[model samples]
Structures are given as structure tokens and as C-alpha cells.
Target: MVVQKSPQRAVLWGCGPQGSEVTVYVLGPTTQKKQTSVSNETGMWRVMLDPIEAGGPYNITAASTNPTNESVTLVDVLFGDVWLCSGQSNMYFQVSQIFNASKELALASKYPHVRIFMADLVQSETELPDLANVSIPWSVPNEKDLAPFSAVCWLFGRYLYQILKYPIGLVESCWGGSAVEAWSSPTALKKCGLDYMDEKLMGPHANSILWNSMIHPLLNMTIQGAIWYQGEANTNYHKDLYNCSFPAMIDDWRTAFHEGSGGQSAIDFPFGFVQLSTDIKNSTDDGFSDIRWHQTADFGFVPNFRMKKTFMAVAMDLPDSTSPFGTIHPRDKQDVAYRLTLGAQVVAYNHILTCNGPFPFLILPDKMYVYIIFDQELAVTPSKDIFEICCSASVSLCGPRSNWVSAPIKLWVQRTIQLSTELCPQSEEVAAVRYAWRDWPCDFKACPVYSAKTALPAPPFIINFQSSSGWKRRHIATDNYLSTEDDWQKMQNGFL
Candidate 1:
């Protein structure tokens, strides 16, 4: 039988012999351990073994205390970092559907250490993922099994295994056309007090219903982290609520995992996710701005109740040209996985120290224009349609074709973009300055502005011009002065 390897997990199994006792033993490379438990009135006996240290290929043996010779042995037991890959149709997108599927599937055979537990769509009112409903078994990546597996998770785990050189466990728990609230726990909704969750939010297959069936059973299991690719469902309808609801849901999952593992306090495990990409349908400002903004602010506002870091892999570049407007799934998933791997490297692994694009450093409100400063390896590209300024933060002032103007700046070092009176012609007192704000109305090719040294796309942001407040100088982002973390405290507190 396959078992989850560990930081802390107690393996348990039932034995038969009505009211009999059982003895369980585990033998690893460096240690040997034993535990005992007796069967109840029913003919079932069980044992809760101790947690093993990380790194393994241990042997576990269990036998009935009665002399009848009832026993089970499991060989090549391991302790490896596991990750639960969850989300909607995007994350559930299979390897076979990708353009480079033949190549990816062929290469997947090389990583034997990576194992997956593919799951089925099961929702419940209160019941957990019962063993009887478990449809798939744990197996290594193979030509037969690789076709239907998640391309993003498989690639992410492959790269992670290459770097860490240990066994990797991936539990695929997702459903196509599911909402953000679907995977979220019920307790999270009550704690966060998510509003407007009327009949539309919970109709059996949507909202927190999946949490009881899809996410609940995996609670106590230990995992390295989770990678999510959702928001296509909720971003458009529940745009405003997502900012608070998303972070609260993340916190809830972390707490559930921590408490499930018997951590008295709480363990902050990394939770990285992919931001929503631009599409034809999302244009015309149907809530994407608010959704994207919150996805960016979550990491800064939602403090890891512990040491865990929250991160997002930007997917704005993944949308294809032909389907630039309505395209939801893009074929450039390899790049998407690579960006996620980079995020894991920085926030989770702490191996690299550089940004593909500059993060927003600060916004200095000047007389005629506002100076937008960026942090990290930034080199200003000849950005054409990358700038937009509104009279204020209200959507009413910024209509479909509002005071939208462009500020084409010259080639310079990657530090700042000056939004002059030329850009903010509608308002003398500029209320808000937005970069790459609108989803459409311009050519997709020329829209990106954050062309950093590493060429990573900068997250979309709005720095409001508060009359009372001004910019406090942080370290200038250069070789000598590097600071990617922005003073987002203002942005986090509804300042924008």
C-alpha cells in the first residue's frame, strides 16, 4: 500500500479478528520504531504509527496480536514533500491537450520519484473523502498514466524533484468549471463573513460544497504546498468580494492543514497560485481589475500566520494571439509552469534572488503628473499603451472611454514612469494612476510595460493620490539599492 511520506503523518490501517490486538513496526535507514493498538468490539484493529523523518525508503510491518498469522508488509516506504494541485478546468487541463504533449509525455517517464493520486469529482454536505470513493491509486509518471494528468502540476513537480532530489507526491483535487468558493471551506466563509453567497454561490457543485468532499479528506495529510489556477468563475461576478474572500480562504486552508497535523499553534505552509489571464470576454472592465488587484495585494496584506509566504505566478503573457480576446486556455503552459517554478524558487525554496519584472515601489504625486517608481531589475521599455490615469479611484469617473491617455517615455533605466498632465488631461488633481489597467481596446502585443532585466511581467497596480499623504523614500532599486517589497500597507488598506 502507498503512504504519504513525512514531516509529520501517522499511518493507520484496520485489521480483522473481532476484539483482537495488533502490533505495527517501521524500519527506516537510520531508525526502527513500533506502536500497539487493540481492536474494538468490531472485528477491526488499528494502529497509529509515529511520524518518520524526511527522506525515506522505509519498511513497515503490521501483524495481529492474536497468533493466527494475519500480517501485512509494505516496502520502499518514503518520506517526501507532497503538493496538492487544485483549481478549475485550467489547473485540471490535461497533458494530452497541450501542444507539446508528445514531448512532455515522453519526458515524464524520467521522473520516477514523482507520484500522483488522481481524484474524481465528489461533493458532500458533510461527509469527507471516504476510502470507498477513492478512484485512483498512487502511481509514478508513465506513458499510460501521464496522458490524463495535470500538465501544470506534473511539470512543477518534475522541476521541483530535479532541484530537491527527493520523492514528490501530488494529489490532483479539482473540478472543471468550479468556482473559487467551491474549494473554500465552510469555516472559512463563517470566519471571513463572505457576503452575497446566496443560492447562486452554493448549488451542490459550486461554492464550499467541494471543500467537504474534495478538500476535507486531505486535511491531515502533510504537503509541501499548494498551487492554484482558478478565478475564471468568480472574477467576473463576485469581483469586489474576492479581495477579502480569497485571502481568508487561503488562511483557512493553512489553518486546516496545520491543525490536522496536530500542530498546537499553526504551521504556515507556502500557497502559490496563478493569476487570471486576459481574454476577449474579460475586457470592458467586468471586474477583472478588482480581481487582478486583489490577487496582487493578497501576498502583502495576508500575513502568513506563521513563516509561510504567499505568492502568485502572473499569467497575463500566456494568452494566445489568435484567441487574444475569448481564449481561456493558452498552449504556452510550459512557460506558466516555469513562472510558477520561479515563484517557488524565491518564496518557497529561497534559491534565487531576482525579479523577472519590477514590483511597484511607490507613487509620488507631483504637481502635473505622478511619478510611478518600480523596484527590482527594471529597465524601462518603450511602453506605448501601458499607462492610464483616472480622476479618482471611482469606476463612475473612469467610464469605458474615460480620461484615458498615454504617456510614451524614452528608453531609460528600470526605475520610474512619469504620468504627465498629457496623460491625466481630464483631472488636474489626479486621483488614481493605473498601469495596464484595461483588458482590451488596444493591441495585446504592445500593452506590457514592466520589461525588466529578467523580463517578468509586473503586476497591475493603482497608486491613489492622497492629498495628506506623500511618498516616503524606500531604497532605490538598482545594483547598489535593491528593494522589491513595496509599501503596500496603504494599498492593502483600501487606499487604492
Candidate 2:
């Protein structure tokens, strides 16, 4: 088994005979041992071992002072950063189901220090103290053991190990086709006016059922952070409420883990999540796009005021129209994991790097041309045809869902793209501008806009503008004014 490794702490725990004394022996690099007695009431014992280095192929022995002198030994134990991986079907997608499965399986043996564990699919009406079952116990990576592991999780750990050169443990607790409410606790759901006991909620989609069984049981174990690949299920149910429920679930998990681990887990640990990828290439439903926006609390980027210590991996550019597992399940998980690792490097490890794509910070509408200014340098592909503008003579007639005309890129500079007003000649004015707004905006890695240096695809966004002496930015979803020129100046001065 693997014990979660923090900066200078590790926890080893188990159940034993009540009121019995348990002695633990650590035999590995920089040997250190601890002893603690089992609780008479709960028959449980935990030993907080001394600080140990990352690399470990250690052995641990637990001997109890019971009538029979019961003893157990754990072989090939490891100490490393354990990351919880959870979500719905996308996260449950197995390593064997991804592209180049055979090659990935063959390379599993190379990662001897990396370990994986998968929790059994179980649900309970109430929170559980311990896991009912474990599908795959802590095991080193190998062809047989790695095949069924979460693809995104494995790739993420592999990437991290290559950089940190330390042991990486991944715990996966996911259910296929499970809704976000299923993993969210009742306390979190209540914040969004959702009832776990609602008559319509039951089975895999029941509120808090999976959280009670799959997540609650593992709360005692300390973790470094988590990576999520969900939101596809939420696109179908309570899509509008996702912006509220998703952030609430994240906050609740962070608090629960910190308390459950007795403060071993950081209260504000870094979190990374994959934005909803594309589904149904031919369909025009706004469900996917809407969920994507809400995934980031409608802010179009993460690590904002609403969500702190978080990172996002945009996946709309990775669309798989044909797959045996269905178009919803994309086959290429390498890029997804790669993108997540980039964010983790910056957010979790405090590395200095460009982790996000260019975002539009300012938009100016001139007489005959409108200029869109980005936060970073531009890398415009063939052309910027993905951008669209709402062309309506009056703001009252301009709805978010209608009167959008393609605005081709007329001129491109260092960090700004110029568009001619003549493109929308049919209307007296352009009320709003949006980019990559469709469900499947482009083919895999073919998005027109990207970071010039990092190659990270620019996430989708919509910005509304009001006509006056000067343009005033408006929130896309809420239709509220964002700020005045003074606030924009503060943003430029790093006050926001």
C-alpha cells in the first residue's frame, strides 16, 4: 500500500483488536518507527510516521499486543503524493480504451514508482466511515494492472513523475454516467436548493449517493490535490445550476478532506479539471457550450475570485466524432492529461510558466473597425473566422441566440486582431462579440486561436458592449455591466 506523502508527514492506519497496543516498524530509506494503541471503542489505530523522502520501496510491519500476538506485514510499500481522481464516464474511461493502448500498456512497467488504486462502484444513502470495497488495491504499474486504470489519471501521474522524479499514487473513485449531484454532498447540494431525498433522485444519479460511498470512505487518507473530468453528465440535467453546484462541490471537498485528514490535506489545495469536450458534431444544441461556460463560473477562465487555487484544461478543440465508446468519449487522452499537467506545474508546484491560453482583456470598437485585444501574443491560424458578432440596429432586438454574423479577421498584430465593421453591413451596430462559441468549434488541435508560446487553445468566451461616448463592457450571461474605465485601469494596474 501507499501512504500519502506531504512536505514532511505521512499517515498509516488500519483497524485492529480493540484496546490492543500496535507497534509499527518502517524498514527503508532513513528508517523511522512509531507505536500507537488501538482504540477500545472503534478498534481502529493510526500511526503518524516521521518525515521520509519521496523514493521508497519500503516494508512495513504491524504487530499487535493481542492474545494471539496478531501481526501483519506490508511489502513494497511506497510514500508519495496521492491524487484523487473522480468524475463520471469520461474519468472512468480506461487506459486500454484510449488510443495506442498497446504501447501505453507496454510502457507501464517503466513507472515502477507510480501506484494506482480503484474504488469499487458502490452507493449509500448516508456517508460511509470506510470503503465497502476496493476494486484494485495499491499496486505498482504493470500491463495487467494498468490496463483498467483511469487513462487521464495514469497519464497525469506519469507526466508528474517524469518531472518530479518521485513516486505518484493515484486513487480513482468514479462512476460511469454519474451526475455531479451524485458525488456532491447533501450540504453542497442544499446550497443550490437541491434535495438529496427528492423523489426524482435515485440510483446512480441520486444526490450524494456516490459521495457517501465512493468519496466519504477515503476522506481519512491525505491527498495532494485532485483532477476532474466531468460536466458532461451535468449538461443534460440542471445545466443552469452547474455554475453554483460545481464550485460548491469543490469547496466542500476541500473542507471535508482537510478536516477528515486531521489537517494533513491542505484546505486550499490546487485543483485541476478538464473542461467539457465536444459531443454530437452535427448537433447545434447549446447544452455543451453552456456547461463549458458554467464550468468556470461563467468567468471564461479559472483561478478567479469565485474559484481559487484551481486550473482548467480546455477540451472543446479535441472532438472525436467517431469512436467505439461513442463520440462523447474522445480517444485522445494524452493531450488532455498533458494540458492538465501544465496547469498543475504552475498552480500546484509554484512553477513559472505560461499555463493558460490568451484571454481577451480589452475590446475597443472604433468607427470603421473593432479591435479585440488579448492578454497575450496572438497565434492566429489560417484566419479568425470562428469569431462572430451580434449585428442588430437596436440592443433590444439583439438576443444572445440570434443575429450573429461571422466577422472575419481583417488585420492581426502583436496582441490585437482587427475586424472591419463593414462585415456587419446589414446592421447599424454590433452589440456583442464571441469566439469559438459552438459545441464543436474546430477539429482536433485545429482551433484558429492559441497561445503563441504555449500552444494552449484559447477557451471560448463572449463579451457584450454598450454604445456610448466610449464602449462599456457587459457580462455575457448576466447582462450586467462589468466595470467602468476606472475599473479597467485597475485591472491593468493589477488591482483586480
Candidate 3:
């Protein structure tokens, strides 16, 4: 078993007889010892060890001074960073379900310092003081242990281990087909004005049940951060309330863990999550797209005002149609993990790098064209064709029945794209513009727009033009006119 270690200390804890004196000994590269007494009422004991280095293959021995004189010894122990991974079905997807399962399982032995633990799936009406069941205790990575564990969780920890070259401990607690409310605490729900319990909602998908059983029990364990892979179930129900409930849940978890661990866990720990991927091809439903936007609190990016110290991985470009589990369950988790790891390096480890793709920094529309300026250098594969412009001249008139026609790309230059407004009827005016606003926009990693440096896909977004003067004033203020022979020459010379 591996315990989470901070820069100066580590904690060891367990249950024992009431009022019994417990002694713990650490023997490895360095030696240390500590003693504590079990709580008379709660029968719980915790010992905070002295300062210790990160690397270890230590032996920990715990003995109690009770009548029974019971003792336990743990071998091959290490001190490192611990991370909790939880969410719905996508997070519950096993390692064997990913692409090239055989090859991944065979490579598990190479990461002996990375340990894993999985809590059993259960639910309760009230919060649990301790875990009722443990499916898999803390164990080093092996073919048997890696096959049944979460593929995304394993791959993420593996990537971090490779970069940090230290021990990593991952704990998995997730359920399939569970909604966001199921994992949210009552305090969080009440903050969102959704505290009332629905009796009809029961079982693994009910409100606050999974939080009580699965998450509450593990709050005592210190962790560096958390990563989530959910929101698919929320797309079917409570689709509009995600922006409120999701951020509330994240805040509540941070507070609970900080208090539960006696301030061992950071109050503002870094949080990372995977945005909802593609669902169906050629489907016009807006449920998946809505959830994706709400996942970031409608900001289309993380580390926003509502969600601080958070990072996100864009998965809209990855579409899986040949999975045995179904089209909804994508098999390529390698790319998802890789993208998430990049976010972690920047957010958690303070690494200096580009972690995200191009995002719209400014949208300027003129009489003949609309110029979309991105924050980063743009790279286009084939021609950009998924952009749509509203030609209704008013917000209320814009809908499926209105004039929302495809606006093709006319000119491409560094950090800017010229969208032709000629496709719209001359009688109508372009009122709004949106990009990749469908359930499934493109094939696997084939999205037309990307970052030239990072190769990450641009997230989908929509921009509205309230009035002609609003855009015209900004265009004149910024002085970003790009209709020149020099700009065209730069484009033709492959400078973008």
C-alpha cells in the first residue's frame, strides 16, 4: 500500500480496538516511528509520521497494545501522490475494453511503483463513516490488476509517473449510467436549489447515494487532485442544470476532503475532467452539445471564474463507431489520457507549455465577410466547412426553420480565417455564427481546425451579433482589416 506524502509529512491510519495504543514502525532507506491511541468512541486511529523522502520500498509494521495483542505488517510500501478518479460509465470503462488490450496488459509490470485501489459499488441513504466494502485493496500494477481497472485512470497515472519518475497511487470509485446528482452531496445540491429528495429515484443512479457510500468513505485519505469523466447521463435528464450542479459538486468535494483529512488535502486542489465526446453521426439533437458547453460553465474553457484551478480535455473530435460496447463508448482512451496529462502538467506541476488548442479571441463581421481571429496559430486540414451563420436579422427568428446556411472559408491566414457571407441571402443580414455545433462534427482526430503547435482540436462555440454597431465599433477600435494582397501572399506562401 502507498500513502500520500506531502513535502514534510505522511499519514498512516486504520481501525482498532477502543483506547488501544498503536505503534507504527517504518523501515527502509530511512527509519522512523510513531505512536497513537485509537479513539474510545469511534475506534479509529491515525498516526502522522515525521519527515520522509519520496522514494521508498519501506516496510510498515503496526502493533496494538490490547489484550489480543494483534499486529499487521505491510510490505513494499511507498510514499507518493494519491489521486481519486470518479464519474459515470465512461470512467468505469475497464482497461481490457480499450484499444490493444493485450499489449497494454503485458506492459503493466513496467510500472511497479504505481499502485491501484478500487472501492466496491454501493449506495446508501446516509453518509458512511468508513468504507463498507473494498473490491480491490491497494496493490502494485500487474496483468491481473490492470485488466479490470479503469483504462483512463491507469493511463493517466502512467503518463504522470513517466514524467515525474516517482510513485503514484490511484483510487477508482465510479458507477455506470449514474447522473451528476448521484455523486453530489446534499450540501452541494442545496446550494443549487435541488435539495429535495425524489423517492422515485433509487439504486445506483439516485441522488446523493453514491456520494454517501463510495466517496464519503475515502475522504480521510489525502490526495493530490481528482479527475472526472461523466455528464453523458446528465444529457438525458437535468441537461440545463449541469452548469450549476457540476461546479457545486466540485466545490463541495474540495471542502469535504480538506476538512475530512484534517487539512491534509489542499483546499483549492487542482481538478481535471474529460469533456463529453461524440455520440451519433448526422443526428440533429442538441443534448450532447448542450452538455459539453455546460461542462465548462458555458465558458467553453476551464479555469474560468466558476471553476478555478481546473483543467479540461476536449474529446469532440474523437468519434468511435465500431466499438463492441456501442457507439457511445469510445475505445480510444489513449488520446484522452494524453490530453488530460498535458493539462495536469500545466495546472498541477506548474509546467511551462501550451496545453490547449485555438480558441476564438475575437469575432468581427463586415459588409462582405466575417473574420474569426483565434488565440493561437491555426491549422486547417482540407477545407473548413462546418461553420454556420444565421441570416435571420433577429435572434427570435433564428431557428431550424430560419436561414442558417453553411458559410464556407474564403481566406486562411495566420491566426485568422475569413468566412464568406455571400452564402446568406442578400435581403437578410448575418445575425450570428457558430462552429461545429452538432452532436458529431467529424471523424477521429480529423477536425478541420487545430492548433499548429499543440495539434489539439478547437472546442465548439457560438457567437451572437446583437447589433451592427456593436461589431462595427470593435472592428474600428481594433483596426484588424485583413483584406490585402500581402495577407493573401502570406497565405499562399504556406506561412500559416
What ranking emerges by TM-score with the best candidate at the front?
3, 2, 1
Please provide, for model 3 over 1-496, each residue's C-alpha lDDT reduced to its tens digit, 9 standing for 90 to 100: 7777756256678989899999999999888889898999888998777756677999999999975588899999888888899998888999999999999989999999889999999889899988889988999889997898999999999999999998999999999899999999999999888788767777776789999999998888778899999999888778889999999999999999887777777888889999999888998888888888889898777878889999989999988999899888899999999999999999989999988878877666666787777888989765556888888767678754567788788877778887888888888878777888888989999988999999999988766654533342122223344454454345435523
Error of 2 at 182 (Å): 0.8
Cα lDDT of candidate 1 equals 0.64
lDDT of 1 by residue, 321-411 (tens): 5632236776667877877877777776778655245665666554465556676545555665566666544545654355656654533
Assess the local accuracy of residue 321 in candidate 1 as a C-alpha lDDT between 0 and 100: 54
TM-score of candidate 2 to 2 decimals: 0.91
> What are the lDDT figures for the candidates, one per model?
0.64, 0.84, 0.84
TM-score per prediction, in order, is 0.82, 0.91, 0.92
Segments of candidate 3 deviating more than 4 angstroms: 382-385, 395-403, 466-496
TM-score of 1: 0.82
Q: Select the stronger candidate by TM-score from 1 and 3.
A: 3
Worst lDDT 10-window in candidate 1: 476-485
Q: Residue-wise lDDT of candidate 2 within 1-496, one digit each (tens)?
A: 6677647367677888788889999898768778999888877898877767677778899998864488888899888888999998889999999999999999999998888999999999888878999989989889998899999999999999999888899999999988889999988999998864658757888899999999998878888999998988887799999999999999999999888777888899889999989888766787888889889998899888899999999999998877799989999999999999999999999999988998887776644666777888979875556888877766666655777878778877667777766677653678777888878889989998898888899999877677644654543334455446775555434421
Number of colliding residue pairs in model 2 = 0
